[model samples]
Target: MNRQNKISPFLIIVACGLVLLYLHGCTRVRPLPGPAKPPTKAPAKKTEKPRPYKVMGKWYQPLPHARGFKQKGIASWYGKKFHGRKTSNGEIYNMYGVTAAHKTLPLGTYVRVRNLKNNKKIDVRINDRGPFVRGRIIDLSYGAAKKMGIVGAGTAPVEVTALGRPMAGKSAAATVPAYMPVDFYSGNFTIQVGAFSNPDNAEKLKRKLSRIYKNAHVVNDLHEKTAPFKVRVGACSTLDQAAKYETRLIQNGFPDAFIIAE
Candidate 1:
């Protein structure tokens, strides 16, 4: 009987120990509430219409509404110096690509250029602004110039007609404008040595050039209040004379020098 009593006490002690262990295991540590999520940022709104911009003292208004624009005037080509540079439209210029610059056309416009002298046609996308010189209506890329057979002559009389809006993310096709060609005004001949935003810098260049050339001066932009100051030499009587002077300027380290008709 005494042995039975001792075994019962030992069984009771074992049961109590198991119960304590079970209670301890049932108590779980809940992970602290996760950190609050961060707030999301709103997406930026996109601009649909481009704003007017000024360059070299001239304000160029982008024509987003004008379609089927057609004009006839002198067309010039730019190469090497502008290759790989950022165009007015924020695109990297590729001289070999079929692209052109128009002073007032909206960026991403497609146009058809036909060289009247050679009867060659080329379709180019407008991705920049230029031909800032008077009387020039368009500036073609090296590839476009070569395709239209104007590389040899440097400049040619051409008909430029706007095609529809450029095909988004794809190559644009040439389209003929239904409207008649509009004639552009012709300007007098001058040799542009340089264009500067600062009048002081322009004056400095003009003074420096005056030492070599008798007729050197700074011309303020007629349209804009604070536009580019143009340093030009020679109010040459004819385009041929201006061209000869341009050649001389180019030979004398002014590679960007070109004839501008004012």
Candidate 2:
């Protein structure tokens, strides 16, 4: 009986090892998580596209590109009359913004306008449609006009030069010129060769041009008493055809020939 009651040393060591393994397994627990991360949000995208619209019973389409575009004409500005209104681009008109209105320029084109009277120069972004009167070309915001000293005169003769599209970001837009996209819409078109206030002279030009081309006519604006009668040549089905006629007219004699939508 005394020999059976005594335990082996190997058995005692094995029992102690099993007890330790059980305790180690019981103590093992999942690790605690750290701080949570904030959820991220995505940015909103803005789209710019060319759209045709009508004003005063007339239709106008924006140009696809302003590359190498230059014009000399009357420039006017709007203050309270058009301020707070929606521009052609869908942006609110801010009289204080360095922006402008052009009848045919692309909505986002950047142009340099110089006042011929004072030689004051200002860079403006085209964002709206214009000084719709015949002789006028562009309409400026109050701030732009002020910068160019045209606010006091109400109107000024100016030279506008296309600077092309700006860079991707607003900060770098003025410094870098980007891509020039051409989006031409082909339809019935003509080239205006000359304009005269006197109907007789306009008729004379029309008769002379009619002998050379199948379609040559005088367009007289009946609404405006002071508006000039315009003499145009050729009847083109596409803008490309009108452009070809424009080149021919320019080469022949008419240096001021330009395409006009019919």
Model 2 lDDT on a 0 to 1 scale: 0.80
> Per-prediction TM-score, please?
0.48, 0.52
User: lDDT of all predictions, in order shown?
Assistant: 0.77, 0.80
Clashing pairs in 1: 56-228, 57-227, 57-228
For model 1, how does the per-residue alpha-carbon lDDT over 167-200 read when each residue is reduced to its tens digit? 4454344354232222122225677777788899
Report the Cα lDDT for residue 26, model 2: 95
Each model's RMSD to truth, in Å? Answer: 14.1, 12.9
For residue 165, model 2's alpha carbon misses the true position, in angstroms, by 1.6
Q: lDDT per residue, candidate 2, 65-98, as tens digits?
A: 4456778999999989888999988999999999
lDDT of 2 at 18: 100
